[model samples]
Target: MRIRATVAAVTGALALSALAVPAAQAGEAPTYRESAAAAFAAAHGTSDKAAFSTAAAAEMDITFSNFKIAQAVKVGTTNKVSTTVTYTLTHGADVDIHSEDFATGPYIYRGAFDTPDNMLFGDYAATCTDTSATTATCKGNIDVYPADGELLNAHAGTWKGGALALDYVTGDYADQGGLGTTLVQRYSKLTVNASPEPVVKGKTITVTGKLSRANWETFKYAGYTNQPVKLQFRKKDSSTYTTLKTITSNSTGELKTTVTASVDGYFRWSFAGTTTTPAVNATGDFVDVQ
Candidate 1:
């Protein structure tokens, strides 16, 4: 499946007024709802954590359900990956989801919900259209710009999903955590080449290739060492590819193998991928049998 990699940044300057963030909390990383509540306090001249503490929390009527983030995300070296986040917003009819002061968003993170070690978010706020008096379907975007420094190679792996709704009026909010999990993976690539193309039948055909994946830390593609890659073949007249054998990549992520040449056909290498990388297949290289 193809994904758009030219999208924007993962986080944007929320429309929160300058009153939202005081100089004291400028550099702090807050949870999705905490930031929204702080915006309300800053705008209302109240910088205290009262808006978020469980002791003074107001009864929230809005909640999120049916969160749908992609099962797996493949991020490459340079482009920003833009993907959609969708969920169902269920709230009391009195709650105004369309209000300018009310905002909702989706996110994925590692660690605790209130104090995650790392997180990825949809830069834009979510907009919900009412499906009923109390239910609506909402859509938003989650973008990843590798060059923006929001991710490291170690960041690729399992991530948990969450959603939040904040009402600027009462500074009350609803947050859903551990809704599901998604795999954040590096984008993989492969290549194939068969030498001495016009060899006689029964001659040895030396095939060489390499397996690599995106390294977000370096913003480059590096060899993925010690991974199994399938050496597959297909006849020139047939569309089917049969896996001839599985070869492991060397310390340099290189694959070299010898196959007995027969009829005209194509040869390629395929990687099954891992928890931190997406599967990939190289374009088939055709060889002529003399």
Candidate 2:
């Protein structure tokens, strides 16, 4: 992914390019890598199975999924370091012994790291969950550093079947004199799942997709309770987005909307809303509802 324009501009100049420079300077500020490693150490736990299972070790892993220097305000004169990171954890079936808690993987941390290895830290928070009976999902939130915990530097890994893979960043940082600032970053994920077939007069269509708080880490946070997931259908020849029916996914993160059209032209349907997470963009397709 392209680095944030602001960050690029700030740090770019240090390389002699015109860009925002990451707080990594010679006078002594934690490097971006150092700061991330410190946060990862505090957010994860160990899995005995991973320590021995070679296969399990390879699949169960966590990494700094996304990092953004949202903003950096001058702390004192010119010493500051602040950023938010989104960490995504992917567990393979071997490691998914607790598939139920798979979605709870991305951990977030917001804080300032100005001194050499001295990162004035905070806690990390996240939410994890498994919505499907067949597919296990879990999600959780976390904060890192002087804000809450001492996880200044540590490692995180879990065992599934057998194997050893790097799960979390491990390292240390001593705070050095530098400018201090706070920043924000936004992320968006849109998951759209549609039924294999259309709903006939005698049939029901169920399209399921989960819009978990984990889906939109970068966007503003919102809550969803039986939020509306609208489905629209328009004739193959139609020109505008027409509403066919409105329905809400049950507590199970499932949605069912029916379309009954006499003609057999392409029937388009879409799901749209943003209550708990940013709404997935509306989708369209042809279905024979005869």
Candidate 3:
């Protein structure tokens, strides 16, 4: 994969490129082999600041399977999000996955696989443990920093995943895309308020709330519009909640509904979530029926 322009420019100057970027940068992050990474950079061609093309790497014998990234990843406005990735690696029996000259990991990316718009790799390499003679289980990190400008709000939604196999010693590597699909979502919030704290029996009590989520580009939280949200209720002494009804948020993301007051209870708005936003539930608003 061509190192997407954003990251390629940041690391291209240094001999050792993307894979071992930190390791080569005067002791920044750890890398498997700085020299190997440099060689891989040369052989694979990292000059294109626009993208680190994946077109050139010769195919290797290693194959990845059962790849799993999170079903959905929710990132907020200004915090680091860490998630795990797991996959099964099948390679030639003679290949030693643990060899010092070898490095491998799972990465999730956006846009085209061959020339992705963006890509995310773990700060550290995936830990692979042998499960059989020709197979192993690999687990790695999918680290994201909202403050780091690596992603844009427009990038939220569906993304694909794959694995990277590197051999610094031979200056050879392989990037296997299309391993899986996952959702990269914005962090979400839901709020609730019920009025007339104390009411007479059979009185109508109104509940109001709003649904919002992080907007990466603007660095603000904005209303999440026209989404189906559930109004749930629970008795003061009860531990469980029951769904009273499902309501859709307005264009401005406002929610309002009325329910008959029968007894003391708490009310809340719960969002089931969408591909671009995560599920959220408002804190319960309590009211008492006299």
**Candidate 3 residue runs with Cα over 4 Å from true position:** 1-56
In model 3, pairs of residues that clash are 1-52, 1-54, 2-52, 2-53, 2-54, 3-52
TM-score of each: 0.82, 0.32, 0.80
Clashing pairs in 1: 19-42
Candidate 2 per-residue C-alpha lDDT over 20-125 given as tens digits, one digit per residue, 9 for 90 to 100: 2133456774432333333222222211121123233233443222222223211111112233423233333444424322222222222221111122222222
C-alpha positional error of residue 224 in candidate 2 after TM-score superposition, expressed in Å: 6.5
- In candidate 1, where is summed lDDT lowest over 10 consecutive residues? 1-10
lDDT of each: 0.74, 0.31, 0.74
Q: How far in Å is the alpha carbon of 1 misplaced in model 2?
A: 18
Residue-level lDDT of model 1, residues 78-114, one tens digit each, is 8878778899989987778888777887777765554
In model 2, where do residues sit more than 4 Å from their true spots? 1-225, 264-276
How well does candidate 1 match the true structure in TM-score terms? 0.82
